[model samples]
Target: MAWYYVENNESVGPVQESDLHALSQQGKITAQTMVCRQGDTAWVPFAQAFAPGSAAVAVADPAGAPRVSHSCVMCQKSVTADDAVQLSGNWVCATCKPLYLQKLKEGATISGVRRYAGFWIRVGAKIIDSLILMMVTIPFQFIATALIPGANDPKAIGAVIALAVVTNGFNILSNLAYQVFFLGKYAATPGKMVCKIKVIRSNGAAVTYGRATGRYFAEILSGLTLGIGYLMVAFDEEKRGLHDRICDTRVIYKD
Candidate 1:
C-alpha cells in the first residue's frame, strides 16, 4: 500500500512502500513527523507505519484501532489500534520511533530522558534575571542622580557625565560577567536555576565560557530577527533559540 507523510503541516505522499523506507533511511522522514498508509484514517509516525511488526502491519479490529494501549516514548501519543513498535524494550509510538531509530543509526545513544525547557519557562527565567539585574543597576543610577541633582555648575556637569559613562560601563561589564561566570561554572544563571533548567552541549556537557560568551552575542542575532530567533525555541525539538543553534547548545530541564 502507498504511504503518505506530513511535513511542515502539509501532507506529502502516495509513494510506494519501498520508497518510504528509503526516505526513512535517508533521514528525510523523522519519527515524530506524522504519516499514514492509504487505508489508515489517522496519520501515524513514519517509523510506526513501517517498522518491523509495526501496528500498521497488525490485524486491527473492525473499527481500525490498536489492539492495546501503546504509548510513544517520544511524543507520548497513544494509540489503541494503530501499530506500535517495540525498540530497546520500550513501546515507541509510530510518531516517535523513526527519530529513535535514526538516533541509533547515527551512533547516538538515546537516553530518552532529556526534557527540553519550553519557551514560557525560558521567558520566566529571563524575567527573573531582568529583575535581579535591574536591582543592581537601578541603585547606581539613583546614586548618580543624587550626586548631581542639577548640573548647573561645570564641575557638576563633568561629574554627571563621568558618572553616566561609569554607570554604563559598569552595567555592561556586570551583565557580561554574570552570564559568562554562571554559564561557564553552573550552566545556568540564578533565574534558570530557579526555573530548574541548564544549558548544555549536544553531547550534554557543560558549556565553556567561550561558548557561553558566543551564545550571549548570538542573542543579538535572535533579537535582530524581529524576535523570531527566540520564538524558534517554542517549535524546535531541542528547545533551542537562535543563539542555542549557533552554539550547538540546548536548554533542558535538570533532573
Candidate 2:
C-alpha cells in the first residue's frame, strides 16, 4: 500500500507502506496530517487510518517540541498542538477548524484567497442589471401613463405629478427589494450571476441580507465622490469599490 500526505499546502507523493512507517517514526507525520491512499476519494487523518488497536500510528510530536499552547490564527483562542490544525503554515484551533475544512471541500482555499473581480467586469454586470431593471420597471411606467386619460394634457398637471411620484416610488422600492433579495440569498444579482461573480465577506462567508442592503446604500457614496470611490476598484488590488470596503464585502470570481 502507498500513501500521500499534505505538507505546506501541497500534496506529497505515494510512498510505500514501509516509508509511511518510517515517516511516522521520524515525526514527519502528525495526527492532524491529511493522508490518502490510491483510489481514495477524500483525505483522512493519519491517526484514523491506523486506529489504536489495529496498529499504533506514532502521530505524537516526538521532536521534543514543547506541548505548550499557541494562539489560533483564526479565533485567537489558545490551543494545544493536539487540538490545533495547521493550514498554509498557520495554526487554527479546533473551534475554527471545521470552517476551513468546509471551505476546502467547496474548492475554496482555507485562507479565502479568491481571484477578485476587476472593474470592467463589475461595470458590465451593473449595466446588465440596470437593463434588466429597466425592462421590469419601464413597462409598468408606460402602462400607467397610457391608462391615465389626460397624461399629456396641459391642464392635468396634478395627475402628471401623481403619476411621476408613483412611478419613481415603485422603481425605488422594486430596485431595493431586487438587490437585497438576490445579494443576500445568492450573494449575487442576476447580472452578477451571469458574469460568474459573487459577493462574499472578506472571510468568505455569505453576506447577510442586512449587510447586502447596507452595501447597496453605501454605493451612493461611490457616486457622491464623483465616481472615484467606484473607480477605486480599478486601482485597488482587491478591486473593491468604496462601498465594498465600507461594508466589508468582496466581489470575487466564483469557481
Candidate 3:
C-alpha cells in the first residue's frame, strides 16, 4: 500500500510501503513520525503502524468526529492535535505541557536529541580559530610596532614595554570581539562552522551577545586550570568543557 508521512509538520507523500520502510531505516522517518496508509482516516506513529502484529488505530473525538493523532514532541504520547499544544513548531500533549513549559522557563533542551561534540573535534576547531586569530594579529603587531617611536631601539626599554602592553591589549580585545560576535550572531565561529559544530545554551537556544562575552571570559578559567577544564569534555556525560559548564552552554554537531 502507498503511505504518507508527516515531515516538519506537513504531509509528505504517497510512496510505496517499501519506500516508507527504507526511509525509516535511513533515519529520514523517526519512530514518532506520523504516518498513514492510503485511504486511512487518521494518522498514527510509524512504530505503531509497523510494529509486529500491530495495526494502525484510528481515533475519534468524543462527539464522534474523525480525529488524527500525533506524537507529543516532549513525552512521545499519542495525542490528537486538538488536544495538544504547539510550542516552537513541536507538539506537546496536555499531560506534558506543564513540564515542557517549565523546561522552557529554565532554559533546558526539551527534546534532548542534541549530539554533543567530542573533545578531539572541539580541539580541532579551537586550533583552526587560533590560526585565524594569528593571521589577524600578526599584521596588527607589525603596524603597531612601526607606528611606535623607538620601537626598533633595543636601548629604549620604556618604549618597548609600552609597545608590548599595547599589542597584548589589542590582541585580547580582538579575540573577545571575534568570539562574541560569531557566537552571538552565528552560534559558531568560522572554525566551528568548518568543523560543523556550534555553541548553544543548555536549552538549545542560540547564544546571546552577553552570554557569548561571558563564555569567552569563562574560557580563561579553562586555561588557568592547565587545560583541565577543556579536558572535562572527554569524560563528561554531555561532553561539556569547564567553560561550557560554567556558562551553561553546549557544543553540538550541526547535523
lDDT string, candidate 3, 37-77, tens digits: 76554678889888889777863432223345667777777
Query: Each prediction's Cα lDDT score?
Result: 0.76, 0.78, 0.84
Candidate 2 local lDDT, 1-255, one digit each (tens)? 777777766667668878887888898988767776643424567777776665434344323222345567666665655568766435677777888667658976444336689999999999999999999799989988888767767789987887888789889888889899999999999999999999998767799999989987899789899999999999886788999999998899876
Q: Where does candidate 2 stray beyond 4 Å?
A: 1-112
Q: How many residue pairs of model 2 clash at the backbone?
A: 0
Q: In model 3, where do residues sit more than 4 Å from their true spots?
A: 1-112
What is candidate 1's lDDT per residue for 1-255, written digit by digit as tens? 887666666567678888877887888887755676654556566666656875654323323232245556677665433367765435676676688888768866456556689999999999998899989889977776666655335667777687778788878777888898999999999999999999999756789999989988898799899999999999887788999999999998887
Worst 10 residues of 2 by lDDT: 58-67
- Choose 2 or 3, whichever is better by lDDT: 3
C-alpha positional error of residue 153 in candidate 3 after TM-score superposition, expressed in Å:
2.4
lDDT, candidate 2, residue 218? 93
Off by over 4 Å in 1: 1-112, 147-164
Q: TM-score winner between 2 and 3, please give it.
A: 3
